[model samples]
Target: MSRRPGRVRRAASAALLSLLLVAGCDTGGAEDAGGGQPAASGAAEVPGEIVLASGRDVTGRGGIRQQLITEWNRQQEAKGVAYRARLVELPGSADQQRSQLLGALQSGSAEYDVVNLDVTWVPEFAAAGLVQPLPDRLVDEDVIKSVAETARWGGKLYAAPFNSDVGLLFYRRDYLTSAGVTRPDLGKDAGWPVVQQLIGVLDAARNRLPAAYAKGWTSQLDASYEGLTVNGVEAFASAADGFSLTDKEGRYAGSVAELQAGLDELRNRTQAAYTLPDAVHSDEADTLTDFAAGRTAFLRHWPYAYRTLHQSLSAEQLGVAPLPGKAVLGGQNLAVARGSQRTAAALQLVAFLTGKESERCLLDAGFAATRVSAYEDGALTCTTAKPAGQAAASPTGERTDRMPRDGNGRPAYARGTLLPALENAVQRPRTPLYGAFSQTFAGQLARLQGGTPPSDAQLAADLDRQLKRALPSH
Candidate 1:
């Protein structure tokens, strides 16, 4: 969820204040001093070492990142390029990750040759000159065109897409059948009203449905980072009306009235049925847990949740659909550190990891792939446990069934649902002050969730003030 950026510093005082307040508390530990120099330049070339600063642990078996890295190692070894990746796990919070990466770059002591960055962080990294811009020849124009646009700043590529993610709608087919309601048509233009009505129908028949299917719908309405960023910002941005908080000119778009209306709609709709009232305070783990436990009839979540949900319920009981509004796109990008001396080798490693073969491996291991070809590859429908092996076929094993389909019957996974959303959906204002913006939004959302019901005018005024202060003119 990181990308490149614009805007310049206003004053020394503001810069110092940001450093003291935001950056000081979150910078991670210094680089490892024990690690010796990077592998020699020509020592069997592929055998060279590359430190990978990962936001998550790569040692975990069956994880997409781990699988991709493992394959890369095998390929490198086979080609006589003995490549070794040492992963330094960083804090998982986006804010913390950005702070740590920025601090490391500024310190010039980070030895990592490859850095896994959130899609949104690309802009900040490029602006700070922390990562190297990808060379034209290394990028696959067709594949990169689809995935690399997010990593660009002023029209230059800064990173390569790693693992792609997007929001998907999940419903209970059994409950829908019991209610005698036909499956809702989830076409490209599906709107909130349609979703609301479907939930309404489910609510009216709650008494007849199983206790676990009583709740009409659920989402991550919590004030946590993920909730705020995804459900609040991403979902709101994709609303038919666009983000109520930001205008087309990248200015404050909504009055307090608009924001309250949006919040009220979200809250009242969920509250009408037996939903988790504290969802506004829950995290991704909690949201996923509730869905897995069958506490709700419908949920909107990332693709990884599909694997976990499949283990808990029969595919027949589960129905996948694209979100009603613009879906939020989330994923990781791989970049070479500007200071690294192994740009060529690192780029080669990145290409191998993001290639069609690696993507196939990722999808087979229960992770989503970024490439369109991977999705179309018949192997995805084949049910196999091996990273790159053919999947074992079952009645429910079809990719068409596993992935959400639009009204037109097209797969509504990352490409169908989120690609358009990225092109037209609301993006967080591309300001260096996003940290402040997110914090303010979270604080205000907490109050609304607590039933404070502040005036829309007041809310808008306060938000405008904060934004202006956060990004004052130089």
Candidate 2:
């Protein structure tokens, strides 16, 4: 799947199709290098090319991640260093990519010096000694507090927070105005009650609404994977004060009463009257399409959707705010492989890629930045990627920038809404057995979405029992 010249690839709202994993074939014309192996004990370190294996960049072809790497390579060349970095995007879903990385690292099959790992995978990889601990300075005060917590295991730094993500509420401002509402800004303080009330107004004005309008809101609630787990976690956290299902050691610490409370919130939010019926079967792609087609007034989505949606929706038609309650923290972290022979250069690459200027570049390209300065410091701008004011050029040579921006060229919502959301976001369970935990948790929550859902108490007891078995118990 080589990219055509001069063609600008926009983010597609479809599931990632399976593709053959080609090493160094279309990576900016880099040569194919053999897999890296562990050097013998006390072996002299050498400067050479380091491979960074990651999942596909959602930012489209030659995305910001690649541009950052290319910039790093250029710096090394100017300094007369022999080290260069190559990015290898593994082909498949996140789960498949995790498995592939695990196999490649454990069996020494791939010569990866660094890996872009999901936040949840930090504990597992660190515990397994698959990745090396990084310097504390790499994650400092400038990094978002809640986000920086994802890079550590047992109080040691295992990875560096790259770009980050949090759930946000995207609403159709036109729909609100159509409902005769004066103020459409559902500010940072807007809660679930406000959302439900606004939904009632939209419902009352359905006669004047678009034909596609059918429900108040939509979200990715598909029961097959992480969608259900994330939405469930948000519900649980919102229901109970300081709710945490597991302890720091990743053991089952939740009681039946707590589970019951969480289940009640989940049920209330997904009631048939408020949520789109298709949400039960919807993933990220489905929910995005439904919102864009005017089927719903409100949407729960990630930051990248801000750019994707703006491509089709004007600023006057769209408005974004913080999620009603808690948002599940998400994004990848950069970790050095334990077997890498270029550990020194690998660390340098990680530092450069996650630095302040680079993070600004990521935010400008539609990724949620991990640093606060990228949002608040209007003086700082992305110097590595495209120029701030340059319009996006399409394959047809048409140039336009539809996404709205602030005075600093950051996304319009970055400082006021997005940064605060990241500061207060909650993480999924951090444990060596997160894989097992997600499967067990999502499987039990699916009962709430069934035709005849079980009572909250019944589901709570069932979830508690299953979670106790899936993870270690106190």
Candidate 3:
């Protein structure tokens, strides 16, 4: 993810490459671009205009914005629709985008009719009445289950799934093969058992490899941030005794007794003898640089890494799979703001963007489409879908954003592994005060990883308190 140098230094280690696919921190700033009614500024919502605000996607040269905005505007005019929709690009930081949106909405002056929200922001937006649940017909009638789940809140759909993302395990294929270990299938192997199996393999060959290969696994740990929360949720979601993050009512869970095993599993993995040194202090970028330099055997990152690394590494040398257990799901969703004169036009815009045709554009632009059919479009050169050496790029270079293609323009990733990971990805805790929760938990998890973990009872109590604090009574 692109950020100012100071902001980059402040990022939680888990979210380095995850700027492409993961949780966001707290909102710290506000910005505005006209077209909304304000409580004090006296700004008036423009007639026949729908403004959509969202964070900038930076996976490629232009950030992952598809041609939907221009195309939609043209289509509307062609169809004799009077309303014209435009995208007001927000800051690259999700936190800052939310802050801007919140400030605008609260002031009653924001003219944004369509708000592009992170998947995790649905509950908070819905709770605050900033955005309205979509009509049944506009919702994805045939979307993938994993992504479809992101649009619903309190049994009602508030948003439409657009693009999606998940964590991936990037490995040195050349190193693994030479070391006589075949990389395990992530979706097939599934969960913590396979993590251990792979861990064992790495441990066994730790001394056998060149001394430069110092660690077997490298992921975000020993820090408190959304990444820590995501790592915990992934482990506990499938761990023997891990509790579900949502209760019977589908709200953020209150009890933590069942989460202990998941936390323990996290401890087990972080404290593993083969983990990269200084990992607790390294952010995603540092670890990625190290991995590219051949310092580690395995890395946990977002799929976007394939693009950046493919500039030099061959498909044979770089392989990606789903993270063991599960990976955190990340991406954006389109919601209609609660107050807008052109709600109908706004909904139409949201539908068009999230539809199959637009999904193809999203994928081509380096974002994972929520529509399953987008992958089947002959354009994507994904290993799971097309034959090896058979791949295609978007006419405008957007397809490279969806999945990586080699110099010969062949598929550089195994969609078989990557797709399933995105499909099975889980959410971090769904709370309005996610930033607060992430900060508190990241600090605690860092303590745990730093060899000063609190007792399970204490950890549980603190977690419950944090979760409550993240979504207190209104």
Candidate 4:
């Protein structure tokens, strides 16, 4: 707490950050509306078209999602069920899509049967009764345990996880080799200290650094949105023994001391010496762009970046491992709209989309799978065929799907790296007022990016005060 100790701590932190700056960088990707009929309670719902609404698929147009829907429709036709599912990709960013869904459901303007809700939005939508409670079987033992927790609010299942995500550490093996690193594969046990040491070696070999390499690492740290809050939570969770900003009831439960610890960890991680200068303002897209450009050696990004980054960098150049420290959990969940008349058929569609096969399909296409089988079970292959014209034949006459996969058809790192990361990932605060919580959390943390940032104790006190205002306190 003394000025001399503070200066020494700052110097030591800078030295540690210096180690990472020389070593790494960070990287890395909606839906539809309407078409439902109203039915009175106890009356047989019509076997009509089921409209599945969601944000744009990051896998490109006619992606795996559409392929699965096409497959479902084929099955329905063969069975003469008369219930076909159509995907309605909602226009706009996640925030805009959330607003659209809320307005549409509240006004009954869009009769969407199934809605894709972000993991964080599940609580809000369920709390407002916009989405109906789903059967427990919809989220069974096969689902990833951490992901399954996101489907419930108020002690009942309201949404089924369609896909799940967690942060992962991506590094350039070529860069490390160029810098003369002997063990370029930072393996499962690689922690922040290990990364810092690696960066120091990279710094020592500056003459051999990649041409575009300007920083050790980069991440989504934009304070205007959820990125900063996510990074903050990860650091907080890593630093605090059992960090939880809000309780199960969404009430403020964190303490000033905990906030101080988290703040300090975040500061150390993002010190200007080791982080990309622009990282303070970078979102996911920006960070991915920078990382892909070879601006940084290491990147902290979501699961999809594995496929996206692979498109530009070869397997020899790209390597991914579990992110050092904690990672925040992300992804969307599927829920039936409360006003849907085709509830039963819609539920069937939901089940099929979130089934073991469908989850495998999602995993193969780059999204994180919600089921353990998608990562671990070799027998569970993605049964859905690629839509016509979606896949092209390579020179070798084999189907060319760009995503790298193992013999089991899972993402190359699915079982060993991604699965454990998802299982251990921390959730963002779950609250009806999550919008307010995130905004406040991000806005307060932005101060840390300023030239004259507040001390950890000061920032912690301010954050603790603001969060208490944004969420209820016990």
Sort by lDDT, top down from the best:
2, 4, 3, 1
Q: Which stretches in model 1 have alpha-carbon errors above 4 Å?
A: 1-47, 57-60, 108-110, 144-146, 184-188, 239-275, 377-426, 472-474
Model 2, range 88-189, lDDT digits (tens) per residue? 999977889999999999999899999999999999999999999888998889999999999999989999999899999999999999999999889788
Q: Which regions in candidate 3 have their CA more than 4 angstroms from the true location?
A: 1-49, 63-66, 77-82, 182-187, 190-212, 222-224, 248-256, 282-286, 376-415, 433-436, 465-474
Each prediction's TM-score against the native? Answer: 0.75, 0.91, 0.77, 0.89
The lDDT for every candidate, in the order shown, is 0.57, 0.84, 0.62, 0.81
Candidate 3 lDDT by residue in tens digits, 285-315: 6667667767776787765566656545666
Query: What does candidate 3 score on TM?
Result: 0.77
lDDT of 1 by residue, 1-474 (tens): 121121221233234322221100111111121122233453334335777787753212334565445545554555555456656778756668878888887787787788888776777687778888886554564352435555666567788777666677777777777777875445566666776777778778878777765466667766657565566665445533655454322345454455555555544445534455535645555566556656677787766665545544565677666666656666788888887767667776677666665554454444556665555544333111132222223256533113333332223344554444434433454443456666777666556555566655566456556655554332
lDDT of 4 by residue, 33-65 (tens): 111223234548876789999998876667778
Off by over 4 Å in 4: 1-41, 386-402
**Which has the greatest TM-score?**
2
lDDT against true structure, model 1: 0.57
Error of 3 at 338 (Å): 1.9
Residue 31 lDDT, candidate 2, scale 0-100: 15
The predicted structure with the larger lDDT, 3 or 4, is 4
Question: Which is the winner by lDDT between candidate 2 and candidate 3?
Answer: 2
